[model samples]
Target: MALAVRQACIRAVIDGYQQAAISGLCPEGAFEAAVDAVRMLDMAAVLQREETAACAAGTENIRREPGSVR
Candidate 1:
């Protein structure tokens, strides 16, 4: 994902948490929940990048090896 998109997502999450708190609807674990949400998002982005890199590498290997197609 692009940096701007990722930043927008993070900002949205933070804004949601702030709105909830301001509306007096915040739960006991609201802070933790927000933190976890952000962490999960970051982890997901990391995993996606890794997966893409791995896939590209795999494709490159197949292209380099003769008779590799099935």
Candidate 2:
């Protein structure tokens, strides 16, 4: 189930990139970079990395008030 969802998401992203490229909106390097990112989209690994980074930054439960900027 998860694999199917992930693959679907990747396909959607790729389709969007291709459409942008066709419209001359996506640069060569940008499209390649996006593809590279999609290739590395591992849900578990990405979540773990993000959790670790958030912990290191001490932003685990940090939040901004309404109308506040980062």
Candidate 3:
């Protein structure tokens, strides 16, 4: 998770730098914000998968552990 988060941040920074370079705008916080936005998306997907797995397991009388849920 930490690796993924770091990679996301790096990608965002690169994206922001590219955008700023192309648009002549300051890259300042754009990268950080973009990274945060992407992480939020990733987190959402993980949560959705967990929810789905939980529902499925519950229906079958099986309990899914956190790490193994997805």
Candidate 4:
């Protein structure tokens, strides 16, 4: 699910770059650089969310374990 969202974000960013390139507003390498930045940000956000979820799940598991006394 997160992967799909990230892929969609990448495609949207690429489309935006292509549109800017078509408008001749972005200089050479600008569109590609923008796309790369967007991709990096998207991946970073997705990974952060995934890590948070994993940590929460791990904590829950530990709390629920049979030997857990607290």
Model 1 clashing residue pairs (backbone): none
Alpha-carbon TM-score of each model against the true structure:
0.37, 0.38, 0.40, 0.38
**How do all the candidates rank in terms of TM-score, highest first?**
3, 4, 2, 1
Model 1: per-residue lDDT, tens digit, 1-70? 4664567568756865776677676575566556655655655656577678778978776644566555
For model 2, residues 3-47, the per-residue Cα lDDT tens digits are 554665587568757766776765875577567657656666655
Give the top-scoring candidate (lDDT): 4
lDDT of prediction 1: 0.65
Better of 1 and 4 by TM-score: 4
Which regions of candidate 2 deviate over 4 angstroms?
28-70
Over 10-68, each residue of candidate 3 has an lDDT whose tens digit, in order, gives: 66657656765576655655555555556545555555666676788788886678788
Candidate 3 — which pairs collide? Answer: none
| Error of model 2, residue 11, in angstroms | 0.3
Write down the worst ten-residue block by lDDT for model 4: 36-45
Displacement of residue 38 (Cα, Å) in model 3 is 7.4
- Compared with the true structure, model 2 gives a TM-score of 0.38
Candidate 4 achieves a global lDDT of 0.68
Cα deviation in Å at residue 17, candidate 4? 0.2
With a 3 Å backbone cut-off (N, CA, C), the pairs that clash in candidate 4 are none
Candidate 3: residue 26 lDDT (0-100): 53
